[model samples]
Target: MTKKIVVLGVSGSGKSLIGKNIADKLDYPFFDGDDFHCQANVDKMRQGTPLTDEDRKDWLATLNTILTDNPTAVIACSGLKPEYRAMLRKGLDDITMIYLKGTIDTIWQRHQKRDGHYFNGREMLESQFATLVEPEKDEALVIDISQDASAVLNEALSLLSKK
Candidate 1:
């Protein structure tokens, strides 16, 4: 069976960084969910607007198709709501979710330093947290983001190895 991991979190919690590291370590293809968003969605978010569920359906479907196409891959996505995560889980097997859990303050600090991304500011981060339905204990391997990237990546790899 294919092995897939979804690295999920609010923006600036390091989903893309850690997901890329995990993918590189595992020799799996990496997909950034942001890259799948339509121009309209990008425009909205670039203007500091939060996306509605309706705006995300097609994007989620595209991620699902990417998952199906790349049997072994790591996906970086803001799988914020339970419904969004559930949408990604459809028609898949051997999939594991890793939530890069962090406090708003921690994420906000990182957010401030990030460059060249569409997600504009703390308002969007706040919106993401508001919308987030944290992955249940049984649904994901939750990793704290307080540690450095290497430590975080090592911890994730260690946990995933057992599965």
Candidate 2:
């Protein structure tokens, strides 16, 4: 069955690249959770502030609603904490989470190379890691981001096919 797929990770982990590719491959809509963020949230990130759970409540709920409304879709989001993931999954099922895993050093380097993104800074990334609760074996297909983007996408496609 086709399912709602979430490409999840910290900022600069290539979630957008993989998520969009998978969405195209599956002929599903692509939703960047970043795009769903309110201007206030965007401004906070732009200012190098890490958002608290309360800050994410509406954003997470809105993403969940989008998933519910479009059951077959792929979304890129930083599902950082267990509660956040739970929020995304609320009122939905058959959601496949693909976590792009990497160390802060790797992600920090990538973040530096990115242009015009609001989510910024090593400090912010550190806060994200601090809040993160890695998905268990059953909850996600974890793809290490050390490999080339093509390799990561191929692996994700292969894993999704099996699912």
Candidate 3:
């Protein structure tokens, strides 16, 4: 069956980069979770304010719509909370989540070099990691991003192949 994979992690965990390669390898459409954000949300993050659950409510709804519309796509999202992931899972049963795991130091290094996005420096990273509720069930793949990107992607691909 075709799958809608949610590549999830805190910022700077390589969710976007890994998601892109996975989508390319699986021949699925790719979506950046950042693109689903509203300008207000973007502005808030740019100002270094962490998003409240209320702030993320509509954004999660929008993502649900996108995944509902394109069932064969792979999306890279922060999806820090289980509630947020559950929101994305609504109306979509054929979904899989890949949690790209990493340590604070690993993420901080990558975050320092990020460009052209609302999140700058280490503020959001701290908030995201703090908010993160790692997947604990069988429906999720907890792959550490501490390794090379190719290694992470390859492991994800192998898991997808099984599904």
Clashing residue pairs, candidate 1?
none
Against the reference, the lDDT scores of all candidates come to: 0.92, 0.92, 0.88
Please provide TM-scores, in order, for all candidate models, with all chains considered together: 0.97, 0.97, 0.95
What RMSD does each model have against the real structure? Answer: 1.1, 0.9, 1.1
Query: Once superposed on the true structure, which residue ranges of model 3 sit more than 4 Å away at CA?
Result: none
lDDT tens per residue, model 1, 42-117: 9999999999999999999999898888869899999998899989999997899999999999999998898899
Decide which is better by lDDT, 1 or 3: 1
1 or 2, greater by lDDT: 1
Count clashes in each candidate, considering only residues at least 3 apart in sequence or on different chains. Answer: 0, 0, 0
lDDT winner: 1
TM-score of model number 1: 0.97
Cα lDDT of model 3 by residue, 48-72, tens digit: 9999999999999988888999858
The residue-level lDDT of candidate 3 at 142 comes to: 87
- Sorted on lDDT, best first, the list reads 1, 2, 3
